[model samples]
Target chain A: MVALSPDLTGLRTPALRRFLTPGLVALLVLASLWSLSSGAAGLGPGQLLAALTGDGLSARDEVVLYQIRLPRLAMGIAVGAALAVSGALLQGLFRNPLADPGIVGVGAGAGLGAVLAIVLGGLLPAGVLAVTGSHLVPLAAAFGGWVTTLLLYRIATAGGQTRVTTLLLAGIALAALAGAATGVLVYLADDRQLRDLTFWGMGSLAGATWGKLAAALPLIALVLLMMPFLARALNTLALGEAQAAHMGIDVQRMKRRAILSAAAATGAAVAVSGGIGFVGIVVPHLLRQADGPDHRRLLPRAALLGAALLVLADLLSRSIVAPAELPIGIITALLGAPVFLWILLSQPSAARG
Target chain B: MLQIDDLKVTLGGRDILHGISLQVRPGEVVAICGPNGAGKSTLLRAALGEVPAQGRVTLNGQDLRQGKPQALARLRAVLPQDTQAAFPFTVAEIVAMGQDAGDFAPEPGLVRRALAEVGLDHLADASIQTLSGGERQRAHLARALAQVWQPVGPQGARWLFLDEPVASLDLGHQLFVMRLMRRYADAGGGVVAVMHDLNLTAMFADRIAFVIGGRIAACGPPDAVLDPGLLERAYGCRIAMNTAPASGPWFVPQAAQAG
Candidate 1:
């Protein structure tokens, strides 16, 4: 619905956008290195460098370097990047700065799905449990996310139009529904199952292993690679659905793809890392403030920033309480809550509009 | 050419558009004028397929339903009544959305030309959220212009459907946009405009179609259709027809005279 003007001919260069993305990527790389080196095991840059260079190390140090810390770092990066990019997608798709996996119920849905698998695993037939062993939680979690997202999308959309107000309302309803279901699952669980549920709800990278990483990496990578394709559609969507259709975007198709991808990425992240909070909402909003609202730049920058922020948070979580590790979700919420308030306070009028 | 025949639209189980028929030819500006709630905007939207309707619409002899949205977009463009942007996209990025629907990237020069046509060239990098309502309306017009910037089909003519485009504009901008529509028509394009201002419609429209009670009550040249009795009957108020030396035909309400 853009109008023509007599003097609207100049092309915008967006100079800062060029530098901001690469800078974030570089920062993420440095953060990754720092995370790889620092830990409770007293590993330093020397050990990290030696490990990377394939230099020989003492057996115990080698186990700590290769097994304990490396997979955790990889899991942190994957989960962080996935959550952030998923947040960016949902925000763009919903046209709201506050939209995130957790707020929209995808996280709670995944959590419920994983909880079900944990508490109800013994009831399934031997064959189904055997084949789905170790994989059951993630698969169930992904299915949970998919169903909830599909329901949310359906509820928010009608007659080929998606309203942000309706979406947020539906998200709230769905999140509450998922939370209640998870609570019911918790009540049914025994002591061991209860401990697992509690730990998973708090979120951590401490349980990360190469096997979990391998299980989640493929889904996360698929969503990440799909971002480039989704970026253009999401950008056009900012103009509203009717105008997007007028410009030749298949608005329905774009909505379907974006919702599914966000659900998948969020599901995988929650499946492996429990309930890490704020990465999705925080990173994307900050990047948009710095880089403008072009999804081409926003999505990738969100991915990198999400990766870096999670890695840095993981480092803090491990070191903050020393031998007794703090939940990563706790750190993210503390960090994110302030930023969320700042965003809300800064644009008091935007929410009203 | 754009054609609609016997179109009927029902929304929420209420009939919005009764059986209606009309045709728009190239190199002409056709204004669909009516009183408020006369289904003026609904008529335009139904033809654009934004809402489901029972009708037959054809563009250049091709049924609209048979064509893909992308293909139809290349042949015709629409400027809706509301142009509110949700995100704080830069003006350039917002305008660039017109090109994103097609298979290939639009040349940056075309986008600039569209913006320049709407008189918003200097604000290309500015955020759309910062623009005033009138400026945003112009920006949206520029986007619509950028969509079918060139007439590429076999007919070598494009169609523009605008719904009360100048409803939010000042007097100067109202004429500016009306003149732009006139220019687009002069360049062998067709424009279907939903207008509330009768004087402006008489000045720019090659033909006028008066919608009353969800139907085309009158359709013809400005002089022929700007009849006092027909307008009075349509508006449920007294109307007077007048001729201006410079503006051709105009309408004046006779409510004061009756009182």
Candidate 2:
């Protein structure tokens, strides 16, 4: 049987896109508010608004608003947007929708780095290794992530061509190595460090603070801004490297830039949020269904939807068990696994290859 | 005019196109016809500066190798075989990609006209991923059309390099695309197309270049180059030729052959 034609008339206009994006942004703001107000020490919308806008609120409410919920919300939005944009860029670069930051080993490497910091903090002097020093863990994580990404990139590229299969295989190899190192570090951890390592490995927004958000925000913003400029180049690249070259794009240069940018964004995200799973994998696919596969639309929309999904997931993680919070990664996996299964089951015949 | 002089392309220390030379004048449609691995596509790629080649290609007396990418892009465009839209771009957007929007901005009306020229105006808003094989080929042809649509300069010619532009197309679309190429040449453009179908080549091509192995075996008008002897030498088969009522000569390969 012949496939039915897609109805594209409604989405062909840039004006419609302009209108819809702002509307989605407004919905995201409302969702953020609902998340901030509905926590254990529940603040009413009015009290939350008063705290947010500097009107009037109790000291306890002010502390909850400023200290707990605000930073977590910011981290959720920043990490969510970063992962989604990086995933979208990697997918385009590989021309495979299944490519994600986690699959490429950046997350594993960052997690290993953070775990090592926790384990080693127990042995070192207080001045040399301070766990609460704001920048220590993130700095180490970023360094580890960058090293892994560079190594994988070098192994995959030979004579200026990146083989997708080789890249994936190398990523798997590196991830396994990183995972083994992480296991060894966990085995060597002391009691206090063990608890910290376990909690961080499971992933959380519980320790979110203004300092962490400040470190993550600029990297996410840089990635988002760089992504839109690459829309045309990415569209050409999807046709394959030879075709992209014929259309005047410097394919090797574009691939290098895209990989570095995606690595930086993913590294910063994992450093701050402790490896939130599946937002990168799921958000782009979901956005593709609504915005079509045009990266110009898909990239920005994926960022927004990812931000919204993570915010909602954070809300569920905090509220599902009341006073004791569940890990945010657990919530994302629970929500993402079913959708992933659906996509696997519902694969279009033409997309099989 | 497009001139290719002693072009030799090597890939991985193996020569793919060996010392090929050809010239196409303004208002001419030249067809390169050969067997599957005769390096027809390589010749076109070499001329378009897509492949690393030893010799020179000049368009209107300007060296294509020395020209900047933007300058060369404005001078020519290509439509390759097996056109696939890996992303879900709209038909109009795919066509607009051919032209540099900075120098030759995408006018909606012009995109519509280019699509209409390929009988694809109705599919302008259609998703490129959703189109059939023939529809997608036509959309790519529209893209090439848009690329070469600038006003004639003092040189008065633009070139189009097509590699098997109609191999996957149906007969109707094949003829449609050939007719469009002929129209472009009639309007003082130069088109160098690599074709597998000899009958279509005989009908539309002003000149034919028959390639064998990695070199041009014969080059002339269709009647001179597409003789039975050259077909046997290039394709390694004896063939019978008959004239089509509406088109031109058609060849039927013999049942078996030993090279």
Comparing chain B with the reference, what is the TM-score for each candidate? 0.93, 0.93
Q: Top model by TM-score, which number?
A: 1
Q: How many backbone clashes does candidate 2 have?
A: 0
**Candidate 2: tens digits of C-alpha lDDT, residues B1-259:** 7888999988888888889989889888999989988899888877776678899889988787656555666667778886666556788888877754223564557788889889999988887877888888889888888878753545468778888888878999888989988988888888899999998899999999888988999999888888888888878788888887787788888897835
Q: What is the interface RMSD of each candidate, in Å?
A: 4.1, 2.7
Give the Cα lDDT of each candidate: 0.82, 0.78
For model 1, residues B2-27, the per-residue Cα lDDT tens digits are 88999999989998899899988888
Q: Candidate 2, clashing residue pairs?
A: none
Residue range A40-155, candidate 2, lDDT tens digits? 78687879767768798888988888899889898888888888888788778766665677877877887777777667745667886654465556656756776777787678
Best by DockQ: 1
- Candidate 1 DockQ category? medium
Interface RMSD of 2: 2.7
Question: Model 2: what is its DockQ?
Answer: 0.39
